[model samples]
Target: MAGEEGKIDPMHQFEIQPIFDGGFEIAGQTINFTNSALWMILTFITLWIFMLGGMKREIIPGRWQVMVESMSNFVTNMLTSNVGEAGRKYVPYVFSLFMFILFANILGMLPIGVIGLHPFTVTSHIAITGILAVLSFSIVLIVGFWKHGLHFFSLFVPHGTPLPMVPFIAVIEFISFMIRPFSLGLRLFVAMTAGHVLLKVLGGFVINSTNAGAGYGALVGIPSFMLMVGISALELLVAVIQAYVFALLTSLYINDAENLH
Candidate 1:
């Protein structure tokens, strides 16, 4: 929570403050390193280290290798179940996407504020999530057209329908298909941001109530702190579920492209 003079600002965590005073300017656009970029880089580094450690290939696997293998199998099963044989080639892409989002979400929820470090959730921003959604959607489009050429347009039309209704149905289907990226990105962004905002608000309640007196501490602060604990657990669940949902939906969309259903 960010505030001055005892005021609370729940949305302050989402702000992307620059680490440097000024950065390189190119083509009339200024690009500077910010907290968001730092967190993203950290996410990548952490993931790399974890993966590297897990790839030691011991004759008898350790817990670290077990975890890596389990997650890899999970992603592989998700893709194969949804996209079938052709999806094997896309495993690398989908697994990377899932792990990146999962780690980013988990890193944001770490209680590092006690250590004077701020944890930034990259997925909480629509801009970041939107890019991810677009990248997945782009793969779908590219695969569809590359494999089927003009026949890919048939995706907007169902298998069998009345000739006259085909035009109207196709138009509606096209609009819905186009909305996937926005909805996909918005879902993850909203879920992550809303949970953080709620937690921040509850944190404010706990602080203010405890500061008031013994009565307020018992009545408000205690309850608020308990609720925050529960919500934090729920937020962790949401992080994992969101990552799975994202990967699952990407596979399903890829299925449509690969099989043209």
Candidate 2:
């Protein structure tokens, strides 16, 4: 293993591994704790730390307290501005999603190595992000119908349409609505997975070139190493942007459902 030709398998980093030696099976499905679950728990712990620290009213707040207050205020403002009075009720859920995703994205970028013991980014996986999207959309649907009743159907029908084209327009709207969760989840997954893969590929080039020793390989390797560093910095920005985009889009969707536009 030490003398392997190359170790550039980027997707290998996202593989799931069991924490325990054995897992229980029920109804042909295995229920076992995994690295993903561990990362999720870690995310929750990070969130708890900030929230708990923020709860302490201090004349001068610490960094963690400031972060907690700043993010809480940010999400609160986003919700109220986007979704209005009704958005206040959903602050907890929105805040939780934002912090959890923000923590997951930032932590995943840490140099934890390709080991099971290290933390991973759960948002990079489609299954996790898709589930979140579905849950949010489910709330949108339930709230839409609960608030508007039979008139909820109005969401499918445009403001003004010719009589004969109503069915076609309505069908198009329904299809667009159905595609939201998939698009939302896939957007996040693709952004994260692609960024990590690029970083790994560039890193591999640096590693392979440097391993080849002091001549031509080193010439190519040094620039590649520099490029890798640059990309890592870029990835950090992408991570924050992706997390914010997810939360912002979720708020916008809530607004669309509540206001029917």
Candidate 3:
């Protein structure tokens, strides 16, 4: 009867279990081997490989070096265009964030079984995204105060506003700034989670339909497979786009700190 309802346990695909057991009242935290960890490791490896491949100094750049150079140039241009020359110094921070997110998103699209026969989905985990958001926000807050000192408070109050309006505007601005981290983090987390879930549902439907009857199953399976492929490609693009957006926003925040504008 339950099967007739076409309901499947979505959480079953993502179980977070402990990696190891501790002895003698140690009670170590349960470190579930999740898809998030897999993709995180993949992201690190991807970054390592890219850095290693491009580390050599050569007058005539190899293809790998050229690729890295192009990406660096791209991020540089993005920062320069958005935040001007002074923003160049922040390029490394932005690039690191971009690469981490790009790899994370891309890694999540791969088959869950690829790494360790575990169903891992990096996007499904909110804590990871929250940490990224917190880091960016921390940078903005700390750097703003460091660069501008108490003058950073001016950000909440427009330069020419009346005294009465200043309080209202300042309060609103403070609230908005406070929410920025949560919004940015949630945006990436939600988008990836929804995309993956949609793909999973479609894939499941195809599988279930195929099991029921051959002719009908073939009709559904072909489109389902194509949809999954299309979605996967789209996810790749989204991964890069989200990374760029996050970096761009971070640069903008930093620029505001530097210029107090």
C-alpha RMSD by candidate, in order:
1.2, 2.3, 3.5
lDDT of 3 by residue, 165-214 (tens): 98899999999989988988888888877777777777776777787798
The per-residue C-alpha lDDT of model 3 at residue 20 equals 45
The 0-to-1 C-alpha lDDT of every candidate, in the order given, reads 0.93, 0.85, 0.77
Worst 10 residues of 2 by lDDT: 1-10
**lDDT per residue, candidate 2, 1-261, as tens digits?**
113556667676688888887889999989779888889898889778768988877879888779778989999999999999889888898888888888899888988674634557889999999999999899888988888887888888888788899999999999999899998899889998998888877777777777778774678878887888898899899888988888898898888778887
Model 1 scores a C-alpha lDDT of 0.93
What candidate 3 gets wrong by more than 4 Å, as runs, is: 1-8, 20-35, 112-119
- Output the lDDT of residue 177, model 3: 89
- Model 2: colliding residue pairs: none
- Model 1: what TM-score? 0.96
* TM-score for each candidate, following the candidate numbering: 0.96, 0.91, 0.86
lDDT of 1 by residue, 48-133 (tens): 99998789899799999999989999999988888898989889999999999999999999999889888899999999999999
State in Å the error of residue 117, model 2: 5.9
TM-score of 2: 0.91
Query: Residue 63 of model 1: what lDDT?
Result: 96
Poorest stretch of ten by lDDT in candidate 3: 17-26
